[model samples]
Target: MARPAVTLDNYDDVYRYYLDHRQNLLSARIAYAALSARFRPRVHYADGARERLQALLASGTRLIVVANHLTDRDQYTLAATAWQTPLRSVIGRTRVLAKDELFTDPRLRRAIDLMGSIPVFRSQNHGLRAVADAGRRMMDVSAQRLQRGDVLAIFPEGTCNDGDPRRIQRLNTGVGHIAVKARKLGAPPALLALGIAYGPDPSVRGSADVYVGDPVLELPTTPMDITRAVAEQLQAAVDDVRAVR
Candidate 1:
């Protein structure tokens, strides 16, 4: 049988479906292998970041990983680079928030599902009024997943930054809301800012620079405040990658 389509109207059902779904290890390995073979980006880490990340994971603390959005292939490079870093441990345990359209293609959807991706109905794609309820539900689901010990990875900028690859775009407050909600649910996730910088021509392989920042254990209480703090930290990470590249 064909899988039921994911839509805003049926978001609650889809969310429930994800809650019961488990990532296939074999599928995840195959997907990561493909990503690694195609994108050979160099990975860089901030001072003490490597040790801190391992400690956090060892303590069972979930991560809310936020990264800059660059080209369409940014996620591929990010995943490939992550496989070469301490992040490899959470490959199948992380739930990535990806736009809804990406799940529309059957061939690509299988890989996304295997990678533990949750469909996000963005306001830009569905209109603010249309996505309001579904957006709130999505945030709730994300928080619940964190509480369940799943690492949450989000591209908070919501869209690719075409104007400047080195600078991070304004982040949406959704990530902040998700963090705050998860904390209120008794699951405070550590924040990890990952920065990705592509060379002048992003289309070329091996021109990506991926930087991982030290995890932020404590975040601001309010959503806007958390968003602002995340933006500042993300910009610093981006600068670090640009400096080395």
Candidate 2:
């Protein structure tokens, strides 16, 4: 499979085209159903979190959902729950923030694109200046999508926590930058924190539980502030689920 050519000059257009052309409600629904049937995961939530999420859904408010990066199946778990919950209305319109390498595989790329995924190239592999430039462009695209009333799901930890599922790793400020820039675009998306954990029952196919936190409506002024705020909120939420587990 020939991967899509991505250059800084055309990044925004390419991403918008991918998102516009790939999102499919029917496919998302089917994928959700298939994953749910296969995993039979049990979803949990923080008090009043569901009602808040539902309200946001009803109002059609744009959102940036930040969550822990657990197993490869975490995306499927969230997708299944979203369809089953009030978020069902926004399922087709939500764009997941994913690493660029995930798009290299034809099969994985197809599945995620159908689920409305936007790619982020890791400029850290090149140099600090490159990282800064790439990060800005990525956030610009994210802001554009949010301003257009699209939902975004990102793992602020930037990668899976191989050390411990309950403990959130250090988060980068990319998630914060995206939110701040989106606000500048007049979107000011609501931030929702999520925590996902897999159950221990071997008899059951990895029962996963998702805990939702209240939406962070007040976005901080700086990227560092946003990063710290999200890190604290997500950590608390994940710990909440872990406490019950």
Candidate 3:
């Protein structure tokens, strides 16, 4: 039997309670795992999603899917599968690199921990030490997960952009760091850049399109190369999906 869905009817109270009980985000993870169980996600564009993801995972590529940040709640759609997919599948429980502030909330912190999040610091950029530390931490956590055969999905744009004729900004360096770090371990994971757009024109249905293509660039020796490749693939995917446009 299919599991029943959960509702946040009393979310405000629940949220407050969680905040009072926060403990280094450990409790948050358990709560999140429990809450995540309530959702039953269906892909907006299942057309090639399954096939593409399966093929990439089958190829023994520690997959890192760099998707453009969009407000259609794209990240959650992808994250749902991370904890639910088969062990050998690309969607197997993933470690996300989300903003640090989200963890400050007890309930949110729990969700992040349960979701297996890795805090990506965007502040303290005035010093190189903070930058290096953030990079090293990301490398350690993500690399460990990849070595254990888990995929990592990140939004290079960091946050969603809201506007008509949606826009994607320049790719972030974090994606590149992930690629290079994995490569240095002697088995570089494949970077899958995707462009997800939603529409039905005058009538909005469940219509959506996700165009995927070959890697923009293979694993590189340096982080810069990986970041550039992510940007290239992102543009390519968007074009491939909307080539008819």
Candidate 4:
């Protein structure tokens, strides 16, 4: 059966589709290869972080991967760097939360789909009142996917940082909500923070430094508390990348 085409009129259905869908392995490999060739980001892991990540994945534990957003090209750089890490083991099994606008172009949409991206309708683009229900549905779908053992990658800052790339912006609470919900659903995903920093002149093809922090196996009880803890850890990751760069 043909999968239903994703349309604005069927927002709920769209989320449901991605909840269980994994990217095709061949497509994921080709896409990452292209990104790696173009970006060639330098990747760094905190002491024991790489080994911990390998262990967590080996144990079949799902991860809520959060990163600090810098330039529009940060995603490409992160993807390239990730390909150089243990993350390559789960390329087709990871779900990246991306702004919905990226899905408008048919040609780019196919590539984004191959990267296993999930569309996120932000309140800034659609207005808070307008995107409220869609936001809830997106979170619910994300939580369900986590419970199903899919890796969830998110930029909790929600948008690119226009100011100092070294300092992480305030993160939205949506990530915390998803984590809490996923725990309640019996998944209890581990948290992984990825920090990215570009050179003085940042661009789509510029080389970057990426840091992978140690994973957090236990989460705070409440959403606000969880967000706070994630913020602290992500900032530390960002600092690590900057110090090494």
Candidate 5:
């Protein structure tokens, strides 16, 4: 069945709707179950990082999860990883940063919304300067959600890598900006780098691996500086997971 078009007419309202941290746990659990049934991925983490992450989640601390973008299915795989691992406790407390075009499909939007996702309009999509407003809204909303204690997951690379799975593409500073702004707004969340790797098949039933890095406590003052630091950390994590096979 064809899904209906996005009904929200006003861009402002649409952005707000996407920013809302509404987590439908029932729906999330169902989706997680489905993804788990399909993938059943193996999860890994840096030494002692898993226990530390679990402790943080147990303490109700909000986190910024950054990862490399390899394929479209990364979102589902992450969701399933969270469901199967200690990150399960954070399932309802996290908000995923997603591209705006994804919201155009009502059915997919509903599922993503249930999983607590915020829409992002990349500058490259609608002309670099033209979508500045949308980009700002995404950052503002993401910062606000972070301030509100919602864990935000972002793909700093912005787009998926089709060539070399090991090499990371240039990262977008939006994630860094959001983190800095969130701190200024009185909600400095911890940063965690997540690395996801899929088998050669790259299908739902393919073997997968997830690597979680240690929380980055020393963030740079400037957004660009922090973005660079985060990019390096994320790349290291990705390298770790990619070598698992």
Candidate 6:
């Protein structure tokens, strides 16, 4: 009845899987980093999160950077923001929770695999039970990674929405569930709330900011209240960052 608590050893197979595909991961990390630099993405952040995150990283805080999934540009935005710290958003360095669709394509698959993205299946019009099951699966992965002190990033909104950062799309409650599960385990990594959007001039290169807000809610959020709490806190981080204009 203990749910067979997730552990780093439980993820040894995944690590082996990654090791077998190491070259592809290396290639992807290089390409994405090159693309980021070639485009010269700019950042305009206001929160102490930049420093706080660096400190957390240095202090061994496993960070779960929740970003706003926007255009392809959002990835670059994260790269630039990450540059401010010792940790760069190099694909192979951390795990990303991405949609299952991205894993199916061949050409794109290699790159995504290299980017350290774990595919997550999201069924449209599925019942909440199915959704919750899928979320727990993801949590197993997240929990395993956190147990090893690896950073994980996910887009809680579940899709790209290139709109006002303050006016975000509805977020699926899965991320909240993961946070809750992690907290319950008492060793879950820090799920720092981050808001990434088109700086001010996203159309042009090097002209926007990736705003990161305060940690809205610490991990181990009340299990009963977690699903809603993660969404509300993450949304608040976005709205609060956007309001700084």
lDDT of 6 by residue, 119-191 (tens): 5656563445555555566676675666566677777777778566566677776666666556556655566
Question: Candidate 5, residues 33-89: lDDT per residue as tens digits?
Answer: 787778787888788998888888787666788888999988988887788777777
**Native-vs-model 2 lDDT?**
0.77
Task: For residues 192-234, write the lDDT of model 2, one tens digit per residue.
Answer: 8888888764235757777777787787888899899999989
Predicted candidate 1 versus true structure: per-residue lDDT over 162-198, tens digit per residue: 7877678889999999999999999998899988888
**Candidate 5, poorest ten consecutive residues by summed lDDT:** 1-10
For candidate 5, list the clashing residue pairs, or say none: none
TM-score, candidate 1, is 0.96
**TM-score quality measure for candidate 2:** 0.88
Compute the lDDT of residue 12 as modeled in candidate 1. 78
TM-score of 6: 0.74
lDDT tens readout by residue for model 4, 123-217: 88878987888888999999998888889999999999988877889999999999999999999989999989878677746558899999999
Candidate 5, residue 141: the lDDT equals: 87
The models' CA-based lDDT, in order, is 0.87, 0.77, 0.56, 0.87, 0.80, 0.59
Candidate 6 wrong stretches, greater than 4 Å? 1-29, 89-91, 125-133, 162-165, 184-186, 199-203, 227-229, 240-245
As for model 5, its CA RMSD to the true structure in angstroms is 3.0
Candidate 5 or 6, higher lDDT? 5
Shift of residue 233 alpha carbon in model 5, Å? 0.9
All candidates: TM-score: 0.96, 0.88, 0.66, 0.95, 0.92, 0.74
In model 3, the runs with Cα more than 4 Å from the true position are: 1-52, 80-92, 124-132, 162-165, 199-209, 214-217, 241-245
Error of 3 at 206 (Å): 4.5
